[model samples]
Target: MSENYYELLKVSPRATVAEIVTAYHAARNAFSPDSIAVYSLFSAEDAQTELKKLEEAYFTLSNIDRRREYDRRLQQGTVPSAPASAPATAPSAPLAPVVRLVPTPAAPAAAPSPQPLPSTQPFPAPAFFPQPPYSVTPTAFPAAPSTPPMPPEGVTGAWMAQARERQGMTIEDVAQLTKIPARTIAAIETENLSTLPARVYLQGFLRNLARQYHMDATATIQTYLARIDSLKKGAA
Candidate 1:
């Protein structure tokens, strides 16, 4: 029930960046407007407020310098408090009593007798003229066969992009399906490893993307790690 960012995300103070990211996603989904789990429990405004808090927590704790500063603040017992609000269970004043008005009774009127209604005779159907029979002919057009998506050709970002395209998936589509950010997905597809998270988190992203596209997750992860190693060696 603590309002601390770590508590809000259900993570420990020493949680890794990958853990923080995972917790952030879980928290976001739990409070999402479209989430059925919280549909009845929280109003749209409340959900949005909680989502904002989750984002703030993630943004702070996911950054190395910010997280270190926050930890220092926590250790010094100087963490900022949330804004104050009205008491939860304040009692309201009782309503004033209402007075009812009485009315005088009126005299009843005599009932009138009902009259019978006139009945109309039904009309007979007319004889139909001769008509031609209509029939629907079934056309037998052959169904076009669907081709399976091709496997990735190599362990490079280009192959990853090609595989994604072959599966007819856009970066946004993959992001939505995988719950990974579109920017992260773009970085992966473009081989911009420097812009991505640590190796563990990057591997997780690759695995999730590969699973979504029906590719071999193990192979994709191994290839991506190998590529990263080569890049590091070249830079060194």
Candidate 2:
């Protein structure tokens, strides 16, 4: 299944880009050598090999153009088959003999004979302790303010800024959370197209940011592309 990118990433061929990203991250973590969950299940070399496959899958699927081409090839049923290999079976180790150890409770000691004793004087009265005076009053707190509504789809930059701020995220915070450079994020929010990368990379950045902000990634990308196209036509 090494040649099958979807299988390597553990995602269906119809998975969305966001789903593919999530699957890639999960697969990479599972095969990481430092991961405690699979530490004993895979050797370092084996982990590295699995990581390479995951990277290949992510790289191919993350790009829109490449994924489109890949999907086309898949529909044509033209994907090359992997070479067959003999099944590898490891010999199972023999089970060790089980030994059960049970401890026997010591026999009950002989009952001690009862001894008669004179009644002792009554114990002194216990002293009283003073308790601290404390009272808890229930206080009602004011409800949190509602966030402002995001701007319309055409105002991409304003929408992005409002969405980020509503989520209490700064440009630097978004950068760290999305792994996008702070400057690039700022450029995106400001609609400084010249400062941003090419359209392909811009699409990925916008999608990631939209996902992080809990916005509709598909809608965000579509609106962003439309805005760019409008600008290009106006300049032309």
Candidate 3:
């Protein structure tokens, strides 16, 4: 089986962008060199290796275009998730031999014997373990209306997205121009309330976005914030 980035982050295939961000953060915390929990089970080097993979997966999945393309490839069985089977199998062969290859005759190898065993036991092979198949159905987006309606009096997140597109700006472009983090920008655009900043921060973000798009700041803030409140109330 190839490397599934979703499985790498321990998220389902259909995870939301916010969910992917959350999982990436959690994975980083777990695999960071300073993390003792992971160190207890795996070597600092091994943990770091995992961190690289995590970052790779995060960067790929965080971008909307990259993620959509990746998902398309995955659905078509064209994506290679991990290294080849040979290299993956190569690790096991060396691991058992390395224990025996230890120079007990040359040096004080007493420490090496007991040292590796304890850590090895705790390093559960999650990547190697069998996980139930997660079905990711292709998401079908609806076609836009043939006639573009007049812009509404109340602003919306969708309007911001539309305006950005009209200006031929990608999400990354907006992120760079506004100096907002890409993940945060994506969350705001998608209206993922759980992933959005607090109200105070969001107001500032909305203002920044408004200024960037030359929209009415006051109406942008009021409309978006009011929508947030309505959603929160509905959720409750």
Pick by TM-score: which candidate is best?
Answer: 3
Whichever of 1 and 2 has more lDDT, that candidate is 1
TM per prediction: 0.40, 0.39, 0.41
Best-matching candidate per lDDT = 3
lDDT of each: 0.62, 0.62, 0.65
Order of candidates by TM-score, top first? 3, 1, 2
Residue 88 in model 3: shift from native, Å? 5.7
Instruction: Name the Cα RMSD for model 2.
Output: 22.9
TM-score, model 1 to reference: 0.40
lDDT of 1: 0.62
Error of 1 at 89 (Å): 6.8
Residue range 72-121, candidate 3, lDDT tens digits: 76665555334311223334323543444466464455544333332221
Question: What are the per-residue Cα lDDT tens digits for candidate 1 across 117-230?
Answer: 223222221121121121111111122122223335446777777766654457775676678998888888788857877888999998887765557788788978788778
lDDT of 2: 0.62
Superposing all C-alpha atoms, what RMSD in Å does each candidate have to the true structure?
A: 24.3, 22.9, 14.8
Give a tens-digit lDDT track for model 2, residues 1-236: 11357766778877766677778778888888788876887778767766765665666675555577666655554444431112133224322332223532532333244322223322222221122111111111122223223346554777788777655457876676678998988877787767877899989998898766656677788888788778768877
Pairs with steric clashes in candidate 3: 3-81, 3-82
Decoy 2 TM-score against native: 0.39
Q: After superposing candidate 1, which stretches have Cα over 4 Å from the reference?
A: 83-236
